[model samples]
Target: MLGAGLLPLGVLLFGALTDRLDANPIEHITHSTGKWAIRLLLLSLAVRPAQRWLGWSWALPLRRTLGLLAFTYACLHFLTWLVLDQFFDWEAILEDVAERRYITMGFAAFLCLVPLAITSTRSWIRRLGRRWISLHRLVYAAAVFAVIHYLWQVKADWLPPAIHAAILAALLAARFRFRTRPVSVAQSPGGS
Candidate 1:
């Protein structure tokens, strides 16, 4: 699981070292990291559905790892944009987040992820108790913002973001359907 999560970063590094990232290396890096971040985030969201529908119980444990990996890629993506593209210009960064809808969406998504990542530890989980679950629900909002971010950023192409949005819709729909499912009397609490 760790190896799988690190593979994209390794490949990105290899590309940089080999001079294979093309002329706009920063653009390539930013896009690559953002793509991996969203892909991993979606994969993490899929884990619960896979467990419930396909009975893949082994996948249940992977949710946290995948989410953290997604966060890692997201951080890299943000860093590439901040350090390489914007050259640490806070004024411009704030301006972009304020003026650009896509940048706003992506920044919102990153903000949603921050607390979730910070509270992912065992000690934090114990400290937060039930509140932890509620807080982590921000991941859904984060995913939504990320999809919007990707969709709005595309200049001419719509296929990629469209597909991502469709997948996200399906996943959220499945989750709602699962929650609303009627339990048989025998399956209800304290039923004989």
Candidate 2:
């Protein structure tokens, strides 16, 4: 999980130091961060399905790790856009968030992630109890908003975003199917 989360950051740092981020460095950096954020978010969502369907016990801890990584990369992505692209122009940033559909969606998706990330601790889990699970379900909507943000932002090739959307659709479908299945003792949350 650490490798999965940190490899992109490592690659970005290496690329920046080596001058391998292409001509528009800021654009490249922002794009890399955003892509990794989305990819990590998707992978985090997959952990549970993988665990449930294949009985992979290790995947349980990976969910939280990947979720944190997703949030981290998302923060980097937004920061790159704000500091590098917009140069801390509050008015322009507000305008983009208000006027641009893609930006609005992206910002909304990030906002949704904020609370989830904040309440992801073991202490929060103990405090929230069953309500924690309900709150974390916001991930589904966050994923959808993220894909739409990506889709709307693309100008030329739509294949990548389309593929992401398709994958998300398949994952959600599988989740629905899994929910309909009978919960065995082995599959139940508190079951031994």
Candidate 3:
């Protein structure tokens, strides 16, 4: 609800703040939306590790919401680039997607996220059961592609994307470690 409300608010705020938005308002909107998408994706990935390491189980409930928010922002990012930046020129956009390596990577990432978002509902979760988890693991791949997309687009500065990549790596690593760790005795009832 908050994210849905904030989308338009963000667009309005950006429009109000700058007349031209640094000479390329469309590009600025595209980049900003893409950056926020990556940030939300990273935040979604961090929830599990945070819950496990910090014992903040409440974070679990927000994971799906955050993932959906990431997808929302990703859709906004793609639409901004497609409609606003390319002016709905399908031919040109197709050419760019085919020719631009970064765009292809970002497109692939966006594609991966679609299924995950679709399956995020309780109905899909119940229907898929264990397979749901394996399917949603696509998030890891999506995060990698998103980071690569950011890295490829930014010519001079790599620090921000690199930081997001690092966080993703750490979160994935934590999941692997958590899975393999022996169950702690303290987790058992009546055990100290």
Which candidate leads in TM-score? 1
Judging by lDDT, tell me the better candidate of 1 and 2.
1
The segments of candidate 1 whose C-alpha lies over 4 angstroms from its true place after superposition are none
Could you give the C-alpha RMSD of every candidate to the true structure, in order shown?
A: 1.0, 2.4, 2.8
**lDDT values of the candidates?**
0.95, 0.92, 0.86
List clashing residue pairs in candidate 3. Answer: none
Question: Sorted on lDDT, highest at the top, how do the candidates line up?
Answer: 1, 2, 3
Deviation in Å, model 3, residue 103 alpha carbon: 0.7
TM-score, structure 2 vs. true: 0.92
For model 3, the stretches where C-alpha displacement exceeds 4 angstroms are 1-20, 184-192
TM-score of 3: 0.87
Give me the displacement of residue 89 in model 2, in angstroms.
Answer: 0.8
Tens-place lDDT per residue, model 3, 1-192, is: 456636753774678485746577778778878888898889889988888779999889888888988898899899988888899999999999999999998999999999999999999999999999999999989998999999888898889988887888888888889878877789767779
* Comparison by TM-score, 1 against 3, better one: 1
Candidate 3 weakest ten by summed lDDT: 1-10
* Model 1, global lDDT: 0.95
Clashes of each: 0, 0, 0
lDDT of 2: 0.92
Question: Model 2 off-target regions past 4 Å?
Answer: 181-192
